[model samples]
Target: MFKPLIKKIAIRIKFLRSLSVNHWRYLFRNLNLKELNIILVSLGLAATAGLFLSVYDYWALRTPAPAEGGSYAEGLVGEPRYLNPVLASANEVDRDLTTLIFSGLVKHDESGRIIPDLAERYEIKGNGKTYEFTLRSGLSWPDKTPFTPDDVIFTINLIKDPKFQSPLRNSWQGVKVEKIDNRRLAMKLPVEYEPFLENAAVGILPQHLWANIQPQNFLLTQLNLKPVGLGQYQLAKITKNASGSVRSMEFSPNPRYHEKANIARLTLRFYDNQESVLGAYKRREIDGFSLSSPLEKEELARSRSVKFYDIKLPRYFAVFFNQTASESLKETEVRRALAHAVDRASIIEEILKGEGEIQNGPFSFNLLDIGDPETIYEFNVEKARNILEKDDWKIGDDGLRQKKIKGKNIKLEFVLTTTDWPELTRVAASVQKNWEDIGVKVNLDIVPVNAVQTQTIRPRQYEALLFGEVLGLNPDPFSFWHSTQRKDPGLNLALYNNKKADGLLESARQESNLPTRIKEYGQFQEILMKEIPAVFLYSPNYTYAVSKKVKGVAVTAINTPSQRFENINKWHIATKRVKK
Candidate 1:
């Protein structure tokens, strides 16, 4: 049997080797239908198996990677005034531009954690009073100029100088900077402030470019618009209108940057308002833009080309009652009644379009990891009325509550001042109606966005101010709630003064241990809630709208809107396949 099989196989091999195209075709033509069908099925199966192997090999070995070419255009609401980091604190546009064009010794990552940027590493010394930083090796500016510790020293000195009038001056008041060597420097604070790292995130200016400029001429210099620094991107061009107003600015990736960005070009277009920015986005003139108000969300979401990223920010908007501006608000029960009467959930739903979280205290629960107080001022109209009645506050003939204190008749009426922005105005109206529902008269004082700070906040002219406070990543409540920060230029909007609260804030600032600091903040919040200095409302989400073409935006939480670009270098508009 083996001999017969071998002889058959040999004969078949010889016959196949001798066969040609015409012979095979003739042979197939003579075969039966069943044999022909079997041959066709075998060929089809072999081809399918080959294709499956090819695809499996491809997918198993390749991955998608960010490619280094593409352009991105963003629409901003304001024109760039001063691109210098020291003076950019006042203008959002300036802050956004400076963030890309400048680099600091240290920077915050997408998670709001402090990371080294220009500095290679840092250490705390002198019992946490001194922070010593070592600069990264071989760092250079866009113009190929070497960067050193002197640049950091110069930037801090400018911020400390009163003539510069930098908004950052207050933070660096008691800090002293010393250059230890060409690549190392140290900053010594008056006290061991745990939040000093946040302050160190300020952008560093090129001393060689700014040293010759006088303080008076600082705002007029051309360098403000065309800056040179050690950031990921550098200014490439600026477009202006006939009126000499900047209409658009373009930036190119800095080759000298530590890590090159994937996007080759970045363009920012300026508009007078959010409407114009939205219009430009709808017209496809810009690839991405941020929303200033939640009202535009529905309209913008209708577009299929864009996506919305709702980022949680460490901020809160509240109604701060000035005890000195109104006599009725001086009483703790009166303040508690006002806080209880106002419906925070309704305001967030109607005014914010359900885009915000109802805040109960000054601190953010998500950011600080602290539990809410057991007794929150829940929305209860009857309860608010009962509290006022118990405190000797009676409803007068005008349908408003009044109380006689120290032989003086004080009506429970006060003005609620806020910016004329549509959202804030609506919030103020809703709050006013809520208070009025509980027999408390509330007057709405809507002022322009520019005048609200200088005219209303600085002078403490309003009895109650509806404003927002943006806290840093560390959430230091000292500046917003401390007694020392009550005067002009101070952020203590309620003019709140409590010795125990002040001690808690001061101690919290100096405490580096996370658990201890959190405990101190919890105590401070309890005191604030008991005193009722401010009626905490809600924390709104920072909505960033971008085209679906852009990818790699992983930031979920940010201290400020500008910090959304913390990982900008990783964002890309172009992609390529590479080995996994």
Candidate 2:
């Protein structure tokens, strides 16, 4: 059967091969119009199918990729003062510019996980007390100077130096740095600190350029505006107003960067306030900007071209009770009464416009997984009144709770001090009303933003203070709750003194085990809930707005506002198709 079929196929192929061009034309001419039309239609359909298949194959093989071109401009509410990382800690604009213009040994990724940026790799030794970093080989600064261990040492020393007056001085106080080789260095901490890696993430300064600058003249140096670093971008030009204030800055891609930025240029335009920034964005003067207040989101949502990113930050706001200033706050019952009186949900809904999460403890919800909803102080006016009444505090004719001790009558009235930020003012008003409903008279002391720290916070002048504190990604409660931090220059605004909580904070910082640290923080939070040192209100979500023209912004969480640029090098404003 196989031989017969093979013979038939050979005969048919030979017959077709024997047909000349004239024979084929004669056969086509002999066909009727219907057959000719059918043949033409079949050929046309086959050609169309072939074309479709070819197009589909090409489409399937190609992929959209970020192209190495385009520019991005962002609007910021303030001007950049110090592009140096050591001094940039206090200003958001400075920090934002520093993050893009400098490289660090390590950096937090989009997920808020620490990853190597300048260092090729790092080793945690000496039971977490020592961190050894090995810089990437062949890395050079914008000035063509080789990046070495000396730069890391110089940067760390500048942070530790008293003359520099770096806000980060406190964190580097007990740390010691040693240069091992050309590209390697080791940092020794006074104790085993699990968050030591976070400190390593500070941007390293180029030693060769900065070593000769006097500490007194460091801030006045032109290098602050024109810096040299191994980062994704470098300062190209700066436009200043008539008063010499920086109006806008332009940055180009750094040729010496470890990872090249897809976007060729980055521009930052400064404004006097958030309103001005938003107006600039609306006028198409900027491609992106960060929201100062969540309430602004509603107004920007009307634009179809704008995309919003609700980024979670490790920050929370609270009302800290200063028992030293107000004798009545010394009573735990009184503190608890005030805590239970304020409706946190209402505050989040009304003031934050539901852009916040109810925070029950000192830690942010995104930073710690130790939150227990049952332990939260739910708002209850009756409970607040009952607690005051049971504590021998009776409502007087003036509707203020009064308590008599040693023949002296004390009224349940205290001043609540807060910065005059619009959000805080609304929160303070809500809290004041909540307390007043429970026969507790609250006097709101709205202080200006510039004067709050010097006149109110540092002096510990307020009886109760409404404030926000950024815990950062590491979320260490030591500075905010430790007994040693109750004084000026310390963050313990509550002036809370608790030996047990202090020990737990210390232990938590030293504890390397995640589970153990969580347990320690949980216990510390329990103590805080019982003691009622502060009433935690909410953690507001940072709203970052970007034009839809840009892409590849994958940030979900940030330790600071600057960290929103964690994956910025990957962002692109132009795209191209490439074969897979």
Candidate 3:
């Protein structure tokens, strides 16, 4: 029956073709010359219309769409020692790989908002002290083990364990995790902490695989070199050089991954230094690389094929005044005068090469309105001098200002301590020159990096400390500002203490609602501006260089170098043409 139907259709097609040919022949043979010419022109016009329609139809069918199945080679300036999430916080190379290999209960988006990852949804309860998280249904690790409350409780408990020595120990201290059921968990904090959600973004570890490992041997475990994760990518291959250093690592998409990653494979190549990294990129040995050091104008000009992206980190550099250490720095007028004397704009432009944003206060993510642009101090030597003079500070014959307090002559001189990095030294020198121009003597005491942290900052020995604080996303200024943190090991380098500011900081930390947090933070900034304890300098941009071959990279905020890969699942190396 089907054969007869096919034969009938073929016969109809042949008959139609024959009729069309005979009609065309009859018209050509019998028509007059003028009529034939008219028919020829009409046929030509119809053919031209048909040609245009064909081209338009072809073009319409081909529209660009994201295509899969490509690999990427990224270069970094360090080797990975620990791929485990519990220990890779300070290692950029390790963090880069771990970010793609592990999934946290919560993860930061490109905009730095903390969103749920392994958890289906979460809620804050009971005065913001208790956090309830519900895990997504049917979640599994790369090895097909069911992801449950046990994994979440195990990770938190391990972090809180003193024997584990995990880098996340500090954040989880005083926080207790309770397993409600297979898919539910609750975390209770000693106090209301707003950054708790951000802390939850720490990658979760597989309980079954790690439970057998002892705490002392956790770092030495081979799993650090070959990790099992529940992220978009899983460890596939690792190659090492003769020197016993990891040369490269290749990652493939996880078969049990919840979502699809456009990138099929990602390979990372480790190098010794920035020069070697840049050389590899120039030679096309690698596709892209990320650097904390911003590129110089000449260096940026050299990379013609690479696309550069600038992401402003949440860190800022400032000269924190120790009021308790120096008698002169204790005066509010003197601190304000010194703050106004330094040219922050010039420091960023000349020393930072326009790669930093001038910071008005502690908040870097625009959590507060900068408050009255007129209040922002500008570089004015005369204004600074007049401020000192109005406060009865007299200029001495030595070109230094002096003030008489309690029957003692104290010169307007203080030692400024900072690290020995060339960039920081240049900034310190620039700031010193500006302060000295205003009759304020500045003694530059540059020390080694470790000495600056251990000797000067930790002990609070310097009169003024020049330092940078990396405030992670969902920044909580409590550790850096609250009066309780003014002692040794506390980040309140300025020794700042104010009842109103303290209350603001404490309340801000407890507020879980974003708008309320922003409001409270704005009030805290206002207090900082009024107090003028620390002179805020500039915020540096995290620069990344990538090959133009990759696309769909949208990095707006980066809390760490690893956060740059937050959108790796959306990045594609190839494309296809499909209908719009």
Candidate 4:
């Protein structure tokens, strides 16, 4: 039967060939047999290749390129100084880097509650002062080494060193971190700490690798820029300049990462300002960086192809008045007068341009657990002049506020300092003019943030300063206001001292109940309103723009906001072709 079928097919092919020879002459009278054969062979080869490629592609779809899902753009004002979490000098850039390259014992939930990360679970011992954390089984770093509590101990010891110059020195001042076993750890603090886990901002380092290297000396080492950690991304490649600065880095996902990350490769491309960075984003040069200035937000809003994410962060921007002065700002009336002089309302609308609401005080305005809207001090310049007159701060011959103190007519003229943060610069100009309107003269001295913190703020050399504080996950105000913080090394920028205010701060930290805590905080603000050490300003809104190609972005409080990226495994890029 098969032989007959083959003979039948041969007879039909011979008949078709004879017809095709005659037909080719009819269509192309001058064509040769060789030309006709070439056309048929070419057509047959093309059809066979098309069918083969389609089948090959069908199989190719079964195995996709490693979890690569999206693209994004990040803007920065300058290059990051350090990548080590313990030695990270610049935060705005380091926070993004840390979230990708490092892991901590615990992470902050969207609601600011502490949740386990590298640590499986923790128990409260010593009545809330001591916290014993146990590492999760199978926990491993990007390099596949098992994680243990000694890593935490190594981190704490490095910060506690007097000369290492860790930025977190104040937070871990009297705390003791010790490894109990291979998996268990204990943190002992001098007093009850309500936000004990908030210290998780200190990303755990590998004890075996970093312990022997002195942090004070390691900052200049080659390993500082190329450090390893237990986060989703590992430093695959780094390019440096002649001066030894990391110019760019390409990060690859860790194969042993606890969970798979959506991104296959994350490349950090740095630039000098938001303008250059935005240009890179428009050209698709970078994926996933921050928008540093207000102008960057405006540009992102105009670009229809890009997506902008604005999460209200715990970072608060405002001006502080120095009260330790024996001259112009000595009286409480003078401080109240200065507070009411500025127009933070207009500044927020014109300068901030997004979701930041006016702070009722130094707490979250939309927090379900705390923050009262009624406590915000209203802007009133009319009330400002009244306070000045009561303090004998009459308009002087030179038109600045002046008064007789200790037999000298001390004119209210002081220097204000700030980083080149654009928003702060504009507000400083506005505040300067506002004080001038009320007959108080001010001189503006804007400089690098490093200079301000180290030279100006630390020495109390400047009379006042215009800057912002990155609020921590916990709501306690003790670190900023307590007399203990008034030391030059502490966050006591304002140098405010009120025993009653200190007591209120401690009370807020101890009380876990919401109602009594709210009432106490409310009363505390009511008292601070009268005390007026620093003029609280409006909390402005900021947006972090991403390329529309990426997804899974939500709001986060500024302190640990990028903790949102812990769920990076869930995000995916659209499979559609990217639009220009």
TM-score of 4: 0.82
The local lDDT score (0 to 100) that residue 66 gets in candidate 4 is 30
Instruction: Pick the winner on TM-score between candidates 2 and 3.
Output: 2
Q: Tell me each candidate's RMSD, in Å, in order.
A: 6.2, 5.7, 6.6, 8.2
Residue-wise lDDT of candidate 2 within 1-580, one digit each (tens)? 3456545555655665698999979979899999989867855755565565567557876888999889899999778888889899888889999898888999988989889999999999988999999999999876688889989999999999999889899889899999999989999999998877888888889899899999889999988878887778889999999999999999988888889899988999999987898889889999999887877898887889989999888899999999998879888999989889989999888888889998888888555576653477889999989999999999989888999966889998999999988899999999999999999989999999868989998988999999999887777878888999998779999999988988999999999998999999888888888899999998999989999989999998888899987578899989987889
> How many clashes in candidate 4?
8
TM-score for candidate 1, residues paired by index: 0.90
Q: Which runs in model 3 stand beyond 4 Å of their true positions?
A: 1-59, 291-298, 324-327, 367-375, 391-398, 402-411, 420-422, 447-456, 459-461, 487-489, 512-516
TM-score per prediction, in order, is 0.90, 0.90, 0.83, 0.82
RMSD of candidate 2 to true structure, Å? 5.7
lDDT values for all models: 0.87, 0.88, 0.82, 0.70
- Model 4 over residues 16-55: C-alpha lDDT tens digits? 5566666866856666789878767855755555565555
Off by over 4 Å in 2: 1-58
Clashing pairs in 2: none
